[model samples]
Every structure is written in structure tokens, then in C-alpha cells.
Target: MTERPTTTTNAGIPAPSDEFSQSVGPNGPLLLQDHYLIQKMAQFNRERVPERVVHAKGGGAYGVLQITEDVSQFTKAGLFQKGAETDLLLRFSTVAGELGSADSARDPRGFAIKLYTGQGNYDLVGNNTPIFFIRDPQKFSDFIHSQKRRADTHLRDNNMQWDFWTLSPESAHQVTFLMSDRGTPASWRHMNGYGSHTFLWYNADGAKFWVKYHFKTDQGIKNFTGAEADAMKSVDPDHHLRDLRTAIASGDHPAWTLQIQIMPFEDAAEYRFNPFDLTKVWPHGDYPPIDIGKLTLNRNPENYFAEIEQAAFDPANLVPGIGASPDKMLQGRLFSYPDTHRYRIGPNYLQLPVNRPKAPVHSYNKDGPMTYVNSGDPVYAPNSMGGPVADPELWKGESYAVAGEIIRSAYVLHPEDDDYGQPRTLWEKVLSDTDRAHLVANIVGHASAPEVTADMKVRVVEYWRNIAKDLGDHVAKGLAVNGS
Candidate 1:
């Protein structure tokens, strides 16, 4: 059999040689007429797209979400309909890291999922931890700025991070968690995912239930010590990514049992804890997780760039049954996430194969750069020709009565809004003796950074002291010994 010959073309027409461009003479400079060379150089220069501002370092997998338990009473979404299953893509990332940053960095892990249901795309954008550093979105930028490098040194400053945390008392709960054992997960498979903010679900009968998503890892919880995590960072910078890919490839598929804590819509008004506060969590004793389904990641992406990098998950992508709540962070993210996608990816990014809804999409949005799908029919609505018409019966989603002043006022925080309760609970109730020891060690190590001042260190120690006198003393002892 004859082998196929290498061919280059101006436009599919064969060219003589790709190695050398046409020139005036053998030793002469390349001619300006070498369109192929020019084209190649131009395309190469424009090869890369912009990276995400947060959750930049990530690993993703393709999977199927199987509804194992009946939650039809809570949500009428087809994905949760009795025994229904849907294709899903999940991405896990470190919030403070760049694309090439070490996977084992001490940061919140982004646990975002994009579900392609028959109804539409549903994205549950969340993190590994249940609560966040800040309750309000207004302080979000400032919190992130503190986590990032300082302006003068362009170096990650412990002072900035600690200063922000000390000022924003709301950060105590998440800060405590970050300094705990769970901060450095063993791998993506060993950690759980959480819908950090409250969401809403409406059943077939138009009854709404506030919910918090809890994805418990089927592999069981596992985490690394501070020293172990730091060692792994040096040994394998992409350890988490590699672990996820290898596990899936070896048929050791990782799974999460999807559970939801549902509260009646009326309860939000009188709940003990502020349900809308991103910094607080609804106690399991009050609202327990009713099993909804199982999410299994059984397949690795064939190409990271095509399948994972281009994947966009937005909290706003809600279906008929699933809806948004008054959680300030959730509300802010509903607008910001998609807007960021539009800026990072193109305006028609949803048209990308990775992000496109599996179900048919009909919209007036048209004529953008890289618009792969042509409506073929007229793009405008109210046309003489019948295009897609909105079905009020299907489109009219669940609604609740809204009666509030149109003023920019803060949501009333609960009386128990002191950040100590949960952290104290975590310290005394949740963590083992070994875990507590490690937590102190981690906090001391982080606090001992040369850039962090003595005052800031004392403030952090005092902050923890507010959580639990014992925990605060232990951390203070470690700080003192470490010369913080």
C-alpha cells in the first residue's frame, strides 16, 4: 500500500515544500507573499484565550448523575425525577491559585458541576467547604484582593490575608476551617462538594423549598497534613489533577452521594441562623440531608483544553424546578458568573461544545463572534413565520410573593451572627485530637510568615480564642513557640 504524501496548501491546493518559504533566491530573505507562513505565525500568536480570574487551576471529568433516591416531593427537575439520570461535567479547583499553581495549596477548592439535563443546563457552582469567608458580595473583591499578591512586592502576603480576616469577623468560620485538617485534601476524590449558598427548589405543585446541596464523597473523607501537602507540592505540582485522571482511567471511578437539606420557604423568615448568610451553615440537627441521588465521575476528558478549559458553569443556569434564593452571595454570583464567562470566553461561549445545552436552545441572542449555531429561522421574535414561541404554561416557573423596600440596605443578620459558634463546634465536636494538633500547627506555620506583623499574629490568635479558649490557647502556644 502507498503511504499518503504530506500536503500543504494556500486553500487545500498542494504546495511544494512547507519547510522553506518561497524567496527571491536560495539565500534571500522570505518574500512578503508567503501567505502560509504569515497565516501560521498569526494563528500561533493568537492561540491562547484568557484564563479564569478565580478557580484557575482545575481538573475536570465527565460523568453521569443517577438519581438513586426519590426527591420528587422536593424538586420536579427531571434530573431528580424518580430514577432519572443525566450527563454531567464536574470541575474541581483551588480558588487562590493560577493555572500552573500547586494543587496542594492551602485554599478553598471550587467544586462546580454542569449538568446537561433534558430541560436545560443546571450548574451548581460551589466549593469544598459549606460556608464562605464573607457573607456579603460587596466585601468579595476586598477579600480576594487580600488573598492575592501585595501591590509593592507582588508577593503573596500573609499580612494582607490575616488583616482582612481579622477585620471581617464573618471570615472566622471559614478561616477556622481553612486552618483545619480539611484545608489540604488528600485528593479531589477524597473531599466533598457543597452548594455553599442556599438555593430554592419547587415541586410539581408549585411549593418551594429552600435547599443546601451536600455531595459526600463516596471514597470517604481523607486529608493530608500540612507537611505532607507541602511535600506533595514539590514532588508533584499537579497531584490532584493526576490523581483524578488516573483514578478514572483505572476504572476506580469516584462518586458522591447527592443529598439536600430542605427547609420550608416560610422557615427562612424565622430560622435560628440566617439562611441567606454565606458565612453560616444550617445545622444538620435542624435540617438534615435527604438523599437525592448519586454523582459518579467515571470518565476523564480526552483533551483538557477542549473538554475542561472551555467548560463554563454558572449558578444562574437553573431549570424549571430549580430556582434561586435570596442568599446575597448566590444572587451576586447569578449575575457575575455568566458575565465573567462572557468576558473570558466569548459572548457565544455557551455555543461551545463543552458548554452547549444538550437540549435545544431557542433565543433572540444572535450575531456574535464564533456563533456556531445558525437559527436558520428569523432571529427576531413576533415574526410572521413561526419561530420558537414561549409556552407560558411551561415557562411560567415557581414564584414567591416579594414585599420589600427598594433600598440598598444590608440583610438583617441573626443575633447569633458571632462567627465563634460554628468554629467552636468544629474544634470541640468535629475534629479529633490529632486534627486539632495539626490545625494549630498549620495556623502557626501560616501566621509565622515574616511579612505578617506581631499585631496581626496576636489578632489571629485572639480571634481563635473567641472561637474556643482551648483552641485559641493551643494556637497561641504554637505561635509563641514558632516566634510569630
Candidate 2:
């Protein structure tokens, strides 16, 4: 199976020798005229691509999504066709960390999946947690800046993070989840993945439904205690990444059950909660998830940089039957995600094998760096020379009626828009006593970090107190931050 032995330059010219570079004599000055050596040195100097702005540290694997049930009644997307199996890749990573940061850090994990379908590439870009820190896209840049290093000392300041969270009340629900044990998952295999925002699913009949995605792990949920996570950081920084590769390499393939909760198209208007709000979840009691398929990751990537590093996921990459909802964050992401990818991976990123669709792409966009193929077909539309033309009958997207003023203002108020309700409910009902204790400890530990200023600590306590009275008392006691 081995090819004949050969050494060549990047352009495939026969190399003189990889072992020794050409020189004037045995002990003379090195020759700069050796083009192959110069080529090698130049390529070596440009080996790395720009690191991702966020979710920098990650690992990915090849997998299959097998449809177990007939969800065609909900959507005409080919991947959801009953008994269909599609090739896919899922990448998991720690947010708010650099490429070399510890995987054991207590932060939300990015759960981005790209499904190669016959129609096109559909990406469900999500995270482990069902909620995010902020809803409006305007605050996204500032919020990320707070989590990242400071401008003055280049140090991560907990005060800056809390300051942003306290100022933005909507961060409570996600912050509560972040401080819980679930934040530090045992491995990428054990935690669940969620399409946190609500999406729109359209049937062949043109009937639409508001939907939410949940990928429950088959391995069952497992998480590390805060103390254990901190200790593991010192022992093995890439614990999660190592565990994933080792498990797959040993043939212990991991899997998740894909389930979605669908809401009637008209329900968005009359529901008690704003159905399009990313901060809220459609209660299972109201719209229970319907089991759809299974996802199994059986193959590890041969080259991490080629496959995983180059892999890009965007919320805007929707197919015919799958579309977006009016969720503000989802709307913002529909634009922002692809824009960042265009800058990071280039406009021709989809040409990369990892991100490209298995289906035939008849796009007029023809040129960019590293673009090797030209179809010889005409490039522009509305031409008599027979270019690719749109056929509305073949694949028409779902459309809805809209009647609203175009303005830059706050969200329309709902009866229960306050941030404290969900987190308070989570703290009071969902978490057990031990869970509550750990959550309090995590908050006190992080909120009381060395970088947290006294004023910021006061605001943090206020933020907690607003969530729940007893919860605030516990955090205050843990941090010894005095009265209201």
C-alpha cells in the first residue's frame, strides 16, 4: 500500500535531498539560491492559520446521523427522511479559552455539528447549555471582551465579567447554569448538546412550526466537581480532548439522541412566553421533545488542523425545509456568524472538504485564493447564454406574513420578561441541596476571585439576591460579603 519513495518540493519538483541543503562546500556559507530550501523555510514560517476568536480549543470527529423515526410530517429536509443516514462531523470546544487553554475550565462548551446532506450543508451551531449570557447582539462584543483578557494587564478579570452580567439582567439564567456543576462536564461525551435558540421548521405542505433542538447523550450525564476540575487542570490540561480521542480510538464510540420540540406555527403569537426568546425554554410539559434520530461518532480525524481547525459552523447555513425564526439573537447570528467565518476562513471556506457540501453546488461565485476549479459555465445571472437559473417549483422556501414597524427599540414586553424568574425556579426547584451548595461555592469562588473589585463583589451579591433570597444569603455567606 506504500507509494514509491520520493522527495519533492511543494510544487512537486524533484528535491535534491531532504537530509542536506545545497551549499558552496562542506564548511562554506549556506546557499540562498537553493529554491527548494527557501520554499521549505517560507512555508514553515507560514504554517499556522489565525486562531479562532472564541471556542479556540476543540476536538472533532466524523459521525453519522441516522433517522430513527418519520419526521417528514414536520420537515421535508432530506436528512430527516425516515430511515435516512447522513455523514456528519461534530466539534466540541471550551468557550472563552485560547487554543492552548485548559479544557477543564468551567465554561460553556461549543457543540457545533455540520451535516452533509444531499441538498446542502446544514449546520446546527449550538452549545452544551440551553441558554446564553445575553440576548441582544449589540452586547456580544462587549460581553466577550469582559470574559477575555483585560486591556491594562492582559489578565482575565472576574470583576469585568460580573460587571457585565450585573448590568445585563438577562444573563441570570445562563449564569446560574454556568456556576452549576454542569459547567465543567466530565467529557464531551457525557454532556448534552442544545440548539439553544428557537428555529423554524417548514413542512412540504408549507406548514411551519417553531422548534428547539436537544441532543441527549446516550452515555448519560456526568460532570466533575469544581475541586476536581481545578485539580485536573494542573494534572492534565486537555482532559476532555484526550478522553474523547482515546474513547474513539479504542472503539468506544459515543452517541446522542436527537430530539426536538415543535410548536404550532400560530403558537408564537399567543403563547404565555415569547416563543422566539432565546433566554427562555419551551417547557417540556408544554411541548415535549419528539425522538428523531441517533448520532454516532466512530471516526477520529487524521489531521486536526486540516479537519477540525478548518471546520466552520454558521447558524445561517439552512436548507430548504429548515429556516430561522424571529428570535433576536438568532437573527443577529444569522448575519454575524457567517460574516466572522468569511473573515476567519475566507469566502471560499466552503470549498474546503470539511465544510463543503456533498451535494452539487451551482453557485456563480467563482474566484478567491486557492480556488482550483472553474466549471466553464457562465458566471452571471439573467444571461441568454444559459447560466444556472433558480427554479422556485423545485425547492421553494417557507414564507410567513409580517406586519410590524421597522424601528430600533427594545423587545416587546411580555408578562414574564424578568430575568430572575427562570433562574429562581431553577435554583428553588431543579437543583438539589448538594447542587445548590456547589453552585454557591462556584459563584463565591469565581465572584470572589482576586481580580474581583469590592464594588463589583457588592453588585454580584445584588445580582444573586435578585434571583433568590436564600440563594443570595448562601453566596454572601460563602464569600463573607456582608449585608444587602
Candidate 1 residue lDDT tens string, 1-484 = 9998868663676766668888989998988898877877887887667888888999999999998888878778888887888999999999988899999999999999999999889999999999999977888889898998788988999988999998888888899899987999999999999988888888878778898999999999999899999999999999999999999999999999998999989998877778888888899899987887899998898989888888999999998888888888888898999999899888999999999999998887888898878787677888878788877555344678878778776555466656778888988999899988998989999999998888888898888888888887888887773322
Q: Over the stretch 1-484, how does candidate 2's per-residue lDDT look in tens digits?
A: 9898788887888999877888888878889998988999999997777888889999989999999999887888888899999999999999899999999899999999999989889999999988999888888889889899998999988888998999999899999999999999999999999999998888888778888999999999999999999999999998998999999999999999999999989988878767777777778999999999999999999999989999999888888888888888999989988888788878888888898889998877888877865555688887788777887643454778878889886665567667788899999999999999999999999987887888888888889999998899888888788996
The global C-alpha lDDT for each of the candidates, from Candidate 1 onward, is 0.88, 0.89
**Candidate 2 residue spans exceeding 4 A from truth:** 1-4, 394-397
On lDDT, the candidate that comes out on top is: 2
lDDT of 2 at 205: 84
- Candidate 1 wrong stretches, greater than 4 Å: 1-18, 395-397, 407-413, 481-484
Best by TM-score: 2
With a 3 Å backbone cut-off (N, CA, C), the pairs that clash in candidate 2 are none
Q: How accurate is candidate 2 locally (lDDT)?
A: 0.89
Total clashing pairs in model 1? 0
